[model samples]
Target: MESDEIVRKFYDETVDDEWERLERHRVEFELTKRYLNRYIKPGDKVLDLGGGPGRYSLYLAELGCDVTLADLSEKNIEFALKKANEQGLAIKRLQVDARELSTIEDSQFDYVLCMGPMYHLKSEEDRAKTIRECLKKLKPNGIMFVAFISSYSFVWDYLIRNPELILDSERKSELNKIVDGKDFAGKGFSDNFYISPENVLPFFNQFDLEKLHLLNSESFLYLREPELLRQKPEVINAWLDLAEQVCEREDLLSMAEHIMYIGKKPIKT
Candidate 1:
């Protein structure tokens, strides 16, 4: 399905403008930043693999982390550079595919953030390669963060918001495949794949990584559109707190639109 080209076109065309506008996306950014803050210290080296438009890269750099942002789209990389310059931050920007990071040295970064690549690599092998590349760049005992789209959330969204789109038998079949941890590459919906907690956890277990946390990036909060738009500041804070409290419940993780896996490389014995 030429998934690489599809991913390139999708991000190059819309990622910069589309994500920041959503309330869900705002929550994702804030939560991710908060989580990263707990692990990153001043002068630490961070590799932001597949970081779209350097949003996190710039934030990390501002916090005194030496950051390098790598993305598949040249357009994204260029935009990130301009953004870094405007903020008076120094960040290394590179255009490279996640599956192949030969230019990056092994065990070089104190932390690796693969925030956007896992969902786009449609095949299991490619997804594994991307993970290995990210781990290869992490120093022993360094932390890594990976994000994925949730199949349960995708199915729930269709049932609640877009049932009409899946009324067709073919579309319904594709949805079933997605639930089974398979992606429909030529479906023309979005190019990215989806994963369930069952499939994701086992995949990471194959690596020499110590599990830290599996969090729902945007939990039930994303489903509550009316409350998100109309609630008072205090109410919103309470909702966010609730979301964080339940983000790690395995029974509820699949309900999140996006899931995050935080792990660390084991130090060599």
Candidate 2:
């Protein structure tokens, strides 16, 4: 797989709409927050890498966690800062790539959120570099939330949104490529790729961290945000409760559009 240099430009162009993503797909944000609340205490230092437009970073900041938000897109960093100020939240900001965060020292943060980098990192070497760098920034026993846009989720997206493309010979061939472990031709999201659910946990095993949870972020709720918004709060809460109950089920991992792999760094021997 190869990378296209569209990450910064694509995110920069869409920075304004970034926060609205959470607004639309409320489950991803809510579940991730629930996990964060369990682990992140007040004054805990956090690194929100590829944390576009300050959604998670701002949430952490508002919780009194010292959040340092970083991203490859300058426009995203600027937007995140502007919103943080609007929310009266204090967030340290940096415009940097996940693969090379040299300015951030090793073992500095209690929590690290590598939220968006995996979606665009095509080369396996780059993916390894990014995770290695991010984990190195985490304090011993600190938590990390590494997210990905699931490859199986993308297949659902095609079935739900663009069914016609699924049957077309040329498009079918391309989709097959992705199913067979290749990157997608970035559609609405420019230069995107997906990782299989089966690969996620094992991918992190190579790191010096104890595996904790692999959450299927929007289980069976993939591309159903519009319907979710129409539900009563109690109804939505009920479904969310069920989602939480079943999120860790390996069978349901691919049903989610987004998934987060949580792990804790080991205390040095």
Candidate 3:
């Protein structure tokens, strides 16, 4: 599946108009909010790359930040525009490829979020370009929030769930192929690269890593028994507290579904 098609399917089947509002109250939303709060402040100029349904962008706008919501899907842009208009909030929407970001001005935003682009980019060069363009758009000392699929999730998803597939050497061997700098599972559009926590630092070193926070966005909650976990509010809160501690530890960071890196652009010469 091409990434665009996958994203279309995602919106069509997995999400609806209420996705934006509902997702904000989820456990992962709380984690993202706490981490992102460190970078964003009132009156900041913010750009949300791949702003699906404009949830985070809307939050930023409400916080008094001037926000630009950019995505590759026209449908998403239209949806965002409709919602923005309804709230009487001023938000700029643009349809853009994450790899080619010429539409946005350089050094113009105080904060840039390259959230979903990295996951769908099947090529390291494309990933690098996405990061570089994000860097170019940031003012000196600007912050960027990036998300990546973590490798450990694949181990659990592929190795644990379907052991028979991995047990067959021929079948498992085929899974290791890397094409155009993307792993076999990452070959298709919807399937993007999953990097280990160890690989992240070197990749970000090409720019500058100001703060790195690994987020177990969907993992902890999804792993638990739904009924029991949902009924006990204290357990969920404790789980989050533990997850936060886990994110800070070197060994456990890779166990996350997605890891976020909050990076900085150097002071311009």
Candidate 4:
């Protein structure tokens, strides 16, 4: 199936339940809240770019931040609105694509988040434009948190799980048809872009970078033997703490499944 189709199917089948499950997890939800709260102050205007089903938008609104949830899919917008209404949370939801978000006023948001776009946009120009758009919307020194998939996922999925695609790609890179340029064996879904650490630094360097952090939300601890990790929450927490401590080091961040970058827009001279 095509990448877009895969996303549509995945969201259609799982987004609702996934949102509820992820939201209910106190540890994960609190961690996400802490991350967002770092950039948000009370009454600040915020935008959730590519905000699927308004998870982060709702969270931000609960924290007294005014939030606009922008996404491309009408279904997602409807879902977000329904959830917001049911919860009595006020979030402005818009069906807008990240690559073309000009309808929003310039320098209007204190914080702009583009968490879902970097992994799906295949073209370099489109990806960079999304970043530029985020930068354009932020007030000077406004914080933006963006997420991307890492290159190390390829080794985990392809070499470890499915070797055929990796072996084929080894023979010829073009024939690889690897998903998002990461996992050769990631035939389950289509259209992924796995960015290397080398590419990520320069990509954010295009803006005035403030801080870069790695989040192993779906890798490392989560991917470890579930039973073992769950049996020893303290052990898991200890490992996670250690991971975060060293994640900024060059070798560790490259292996993360998702990286959260905290960047600031430069003030005009």
Candidate 5:
């Protein structure tokens, strides 16, 4: 299947429930909120690129940010609009491709939250174009938040959860490709591009953006068995606290299932 079709179908079928089910998803959402609070003020204009179902957009709207959500999936936009109306939150929802935000004027937003596009844009050219477009949409010194699936974490996950894949010749080749920062799309997997921590900065260096921080969205949480990690609320909260403290630790960053790169567009002198 083509990348856009695969992504659209995946979200259309699963956007309603899959994200809320995982412990890691909850951690990612919490960390995202924490970072947004740190950088955004009330009344700021935020562009949430590829924001499925308005998860972050609704939260930002509630916090008084003028939020606009753009996504490729029509079903996602439908769900997002429904949720926004239900919550009595007013937010702009656009069903559009992240790479082609031509309708939005340049330098119009205070912050750009690109949490989903990087995961599926397989080619380096596509990724760079997407990032550049996002930066273009932000005002001078405006912040951009981009997220990626970490290659190391994916490999580690397979080793721990599905070791049989490592033994099978065909599956091993696909796994090796993923470890090499590529992905294979199929019935079980959406088209994705896994990125290594070491390569992330260099990948985005072409743009005139200042690096603010690189964080592991779910650091130590990835190491814990999901069933065990879900047992105690207090323990889980403490673990999340620990994740916040060590999110920027370089040694542990690549081990996270999701990695976030926060950068600011430099103000021209």
Candidate 6:
């Protein structure tokens, strides 16, 4: 219940901030959308499990997909509904936990977006349970997009946000603890689980799913200060094209902040 409380309290307090995260992080949003569009069709039924404020759900609905947004925070659901109404997009909402999606019928959704839950599931059992629940709701051969915060995200974050602490030898041990998915001492989101870059694909391979993709959401454009690139339309387009070209490159996967795994549930033989 502590994990649940952490997720609800954090997301509830930052509903508007969460909504703008995608808008501000242009590459993360655009590249993720590109990957989603590649597999999902116009009329697909999409379940955005743990979707905060329904950003993706609203986007999918606008593209003619039937979407249901679910999250642990009642506030997120309310905010998502409000946004959906303002956008004139009709998307269903549910206040549900990712590990327990029993209210949703099994094997109905064409796509399952289990993006946010994995980020906070600190235990292996909770992660696997949530994955099973997502798979249970997914139709055979359905596409599932799961997102992960890279184990080393804090390394980059520290260098950017806390430059002064780098020289502190004491900070090295702190970062090491964070790499193993523990909470950082003083900042950022709490109770988040970080995945090692090398283990991203292999972790999901244990399941009965075909690996479609394992790539960084921001790709090579991450620390390059993408916000500056956004000012030039042509440059942003070309950079996005380059990112999509190399996003799935295996060698470059570890340098990203957010990693996404695209998998397809295999139909029973």
> Which predicted model would earn the best lDDT?
6
Clash pairs (backbone) in predicted model 2:
none
TM per candidate = 0.90, 0.93, 0.80, 0.78, 0.91, 0.93
lDDT of each model, Cα atoms only?
A: 0.82, 0.83, 0.71, 0.68, 0.82, 0.85
Candidate 6 residue-wise lDDT at 139: 97
Q: Which ten residues in a row are the worst by lDDT in model 5?
A: 179-188
Cα lDDT of model 3 by residue, 108-135, tens digit? 9999988778777767888899998898
State the number of backbone clashes in model 2: 0
TM-score-wise, the better of 4 and 6 is 6
**lDDT of candidate 1 over 44-79, digit per residue (tens):** 999999998888898999999999999998888888
> Compared to the true structure, candidate 3 yields what TM-score?
0.80
lDDT of 5 by residue, 1-269 (tens): 67788888888898767446443457777776788889999899999999887888988999999999999888878888898899999999788888888988899999999998988888888889899899889999899999987776557778778878888887676567654664433323577777777788888779999999999887666666465466788887877777788888899876788899999999999
Query: Which 10 consecutive residues of model 4 have the lowest summed lDDT?
Result: 181-190
TM-score of model 2 (CA atoms): 0.93
CA shift of 131, model 4, Å: 0.9
Candidate 4 residue runs with Cα over 4 Å from true position: 1-14, 17-32, 158-188, 208-220, 228-240
- List RMSD in Å for every model shown: 2.2, 2.2, 4.1, 4.4, 2.4, 2.4
Task: Supply candidate 1's per-residue lDDT for 151.
Answer: 72
**Segments of candidate 6 deviating more than 4 angstroms:** 168-170, 177-187
Worst 10 residues of 3 by lDDT: 176-185
Tens digits of per-residue lDDT for model 6, 133-206? 99999999898999988877878788877877767877776577644754332334767877778877667867
Q: Write model 4 residue lDDT over 58-145, tens digit each, in one string.
A: 8788778899998766677788888888988899977776888789889999999888777677777888888888888999878888
Q: What does candidate 4 score in Cα RMSD to the true structure? A: 4.4
Q: On a 0 to 100 scale, what is the lDDT of residue 234 in model 6? A: 87
